[model samples]
Target: MNPILQTTINKAKTIPISEERKAILQEFIQYIQQKVDAGKTVNLNFICTHNSRRSQFSQIWAQTAADLNGIEAACFSGGVEVTEFNERAVNSIKRAGFRVTKNGLENPKYFIFHSDDSEPIVAFSKIFDDSANAPTGFAAIMTCSHADENCPFIPGAEARIPVRYEDPKAFDGTPEESEKYDERSLQIASEMFYVFSKIKK
Candidate 1:
């Protein structure tokens, strides 16, 4: 396993993490680990209204969870509108102990923190980068409702899954906002682990 992934797994140990979350993580780890063990490359595109909070969290944690489980898969994201990636989301990932780096020619330098030998989350434009964002066959995972309804056809998705998440942005500026965001992040992380855990070998 990669050192960064080990770091993430260690961090995954903190915060009195729940049994449900652990089960989900373990399941996800088991499933995706099988895929990687078979030498397959899984491509996931996590989407939302903006390429900001909820989708970002899903992308990060899903990829991290995959890595922690020893899966060799990549993650990407996009938005209905070109909203900037949330700084808070990035900060949360960093605080969770993953190393982040920037890479982009024009769009937001898709920040990536390597946890495995998988490709980083590349900054891909919704209007362009069809190859990277959509590819020939990929999963269009709707992490929010707006992206799902607005983008009825994702041009190249082999499958579309609604993994909706509560918008932490809703709690913005409130006293519980930070807690809410962290909670939201944890929830997505937990679920991604669960889904990947069931991936067919």
Candidate 2:
């Protein structure tokens, strides 16, 4: 891993997750463990109303946690509608210790790297069932309540799990924007670390 990201992961592991939150995360952890024991590939698709903020963070952090824990898992993110991945969210992730490279103008593709040894995660904003995503045998992790409540069904998803997070979009142009974005990113990273840490080898 990139030294900075390794440091970020170390810090994330130390964050205190409340009991209530842990209980909620336990369900997802159990799902992952069951799938692994059954020898099935574990794919997680984090979905939100827009592939901008919360879902993006979830996908990246989950993948990072999986890599760190030696879990065979693929992570992806999508939205109900197609829009460019918000730049603010991208910047927030950079603040969390990723080195990012960008391509394209409209709906730009972001190649995020945590380590030189691994392939970069290719990210862009798109609808949940975009061609880049797995067609089946993946869990649809709802990262925003709006997407979860609005999209009643996700075809090809083995599981539709709602793991909602508050949108930092509310602070978009405010003075608290950077602070809130970093806070949200850390919260997701911490939960992902906790979830993967519970997996039995």
Candidate 3:
């Protein structure tokens, strides 16, 4: 491992991540760094079936992580089709401590909830209506298998990276649901913080 990576890795293990998960988190940081350091603005589109739970988590944390680590990047989300951003996901991120604001409530354009200091993470049902609203030739990030295979080609994406995460939605409606949701959200936040902490600039 790079000496700097080792120094920052200590931050990740402090979170309750398994060996495999910790590795995934590290690799993701490295991937984003490699992409962004090329003097390019990285547009990461984290996708799920509904553009709801897992993708939403990735969108906020990725932007927050980029800001905390001083990396310039943009994060977005999409589904194979149109659907609402899940409320439970929004509530989970809020409980995990994101700055959430409903900009266009009820027929509004989007719901922007992000750290005020960070580049706002944009969450919508599909790709942004305007190309200028996003990075041209963005990176297609598949957060779920359904998206990974179903959508083989994301228009204008320079690359596609699959960074799948555990779906706490599986626990929905069960006794342990809320606990799992919050637990998973914390886990995502901690790992993201660890990643941003790794960047040199």
Alpha-carbon lDDT, every model = 0.66, 0.90, 0.66
Q: Highest TM-score among the candidates is held by which one?
A: 2
List candidate 3 segments past 4 Å from native. Answer: 1-13, 22-27, 103-119, 127-135
The C-alpha TM-scores of every prediction are: 0.73, 0.97, 0.77
- Per-residue CA lDDT of model 2 for 1-201, tens digit only, reads 667777788888889999988887877998899988988778999999989999999989998888878999999999999888789999988988898999999999999987777678888998999989998998999999899999999999988888889999999999999999988999999999999989986
For model 3, residues 38-109, the per-residue Cα lDDT tens digits are 877667777777776777777777776676566877777777766666676776666555556665554223
Model 1 TM-score, 2 decimals: 0.73
lDDT leader: 2
Candidate 2 lDDT trough over 10 residues, lowest sum: 1-10
The local distance difference test score of model 2 is 0.90
Q: 1 or 3, which is superior by TM-score?
A: 3
Give the per-residue Cα lDDT of candidate 1 at 189: 64
